[model samples]
Target: MSKDYRSFFGLSGPAFNKQIPAEAIYRYPHLEELHYYLAAAVADGAVAVVTGPVGAGKSTALRAFLTNLDPLRYVVIYVGYTSSDRALFREVAHGLGLSPSYLKGDLLNQLHGAIEHAWLGKQRSTLLVVDDAHLLADSLLTELRQMLNFQMDSATPLGLLLVGQPTLAARLKESQHEALSQRTLIRYTLAGLSRSETSEYGRAHMLAVDGDPDVFTAEAVDLAFQQAKGIPREIGNLCVYALIRAAWQEVRSVDRKVMGEVIQAQKGP
Candidate 1:
């Protein structure tokens, strides 16, 4: 069995897990504002694009938004990763509770029909979230553009959200993708956490697992933020390492010296 860090630290459970509850995830004010924009985009049946560097909490924000949605009024489909157009359509079909076809065109028709029925016949909203969209081929991007062409007007029956790394925006700006880019309703780029946000984030996770908020000294946290560059994933890694290092040394609290040792250990042999 894997080592139980929580028990070792006299805590209730794993604190730094990626799959923590949405409510438990620290909601910096900026992230909450971004979530508001995304929620509005979903309600208006718009194609929204969210770009950010890896480990910037884009997926976490998406999960929080979906969790708060009204299930009776909206159908949410999340495809975390898709490499090809056929796979994308198949995922959508599966999300809609339909068996997908081998043919790409047939799959497209089936997905569109299901989306229309959900929006019109059932009076429900359809939200399709495609994560790691940056990896999709150009041809697939064209197909996605066509799917959103519900009517002559800009209004679409389905709300689409494309989430990926920062390079996704540049890909959309290519000449061949102008048509799709023009149809984007809103674009938001997620940035790393600010210093204050990082500090609060650290305390939040530690406290969530029943660890003392002051387990890490202020100077130690400052070093962590400097080393992690305010990225949540990196911060989590540094914190976990510090915890284990402190336990090994029989230290009650992590200080700058402990963090420095952790950083050096992470550097190399």
Candidate 2:
């Protein structure tokens, strides 16, 4: 029979699962700052850019912030994949529960009318979030900039949030994108956790699953921070893998030796 790690470790549920409740997520300082900037951007109907390294918890922070927003006051449209302007608009229309028009002009008009109605009629602000924006083509970027033009550029009923890797920030700095760059009112770069914060994050995940935090020794956590470089996702991955290895060996605690073995095994021959 396969070993039940959760049962063996006395955990009530799986640990390190990405689908964990938002309230159980560890609140890093950067997450708090991100929430503040996101809220400010939506309130001002402005544009914001959030960039970070891979596995730096950028999307996790974004999800947490969006979950806390007042649904009655704001309508959020999130698009994670888009290669062109049409695809982007179609995604937005779908998010609004409208059938996407086949023609570009019709689709654009449909999107505009939806945003207008949501703001003026329903009294709700529309916030559009595009993830992985670094891959956006220049033409698509230009289309996005044009979408912000409302009421002679005097009134902004829609807020735009572009989230991607650090390259997305660099892409915005080009002279060709100067117009769009100038419109960005808020920008924040997310960073990984500190060693202390890494330890807290590990313990928090354990506590979240109702597992004994001591399953990972302090030294093991210290080594994990060093190996994972304090990235929350990497830390969680390392801890979970280590736990599996410990369970296989019938060990109760993951110490420095067990952590080292797991790290070495991951490095391959």
Best candidate according to lDDT: 2
Cα shift from native, residue 26, model 1 (Å): 0.4
Put down candidate 1 lDDT per residue, 1-269, tens digits, no spaces. Answer: 32355666787776677787788889998689889899889889888999989888888888888999998889999987767778788888999999998888888888888888887787787898999988888998898888886743643578889999988999999999999898898899988888888889888888777888788898888889999898889988999888888877777788999999999899888
Candidate 1, clashing residue pairs? none
For each candidate, what is the lDDT?
Answer: 0.85, 0.88
Model 1 weakest lDDT span, ten residues long? 1-10
Q: Write the per-residue lDDT of candidate 2 for residues 143-228, one digit (tens) a residue.
A: 99899877635557899999999999999999999999999999899999998888778888899999987788888988899998
| Candidate 2: stretches off by over 4 Å | 152-154
lDDT of 1 at 196: 86
lDDT of 2 at 89: 95
Question: How much is the lDDT of residue 26 in candidate 2?
Answer: 90
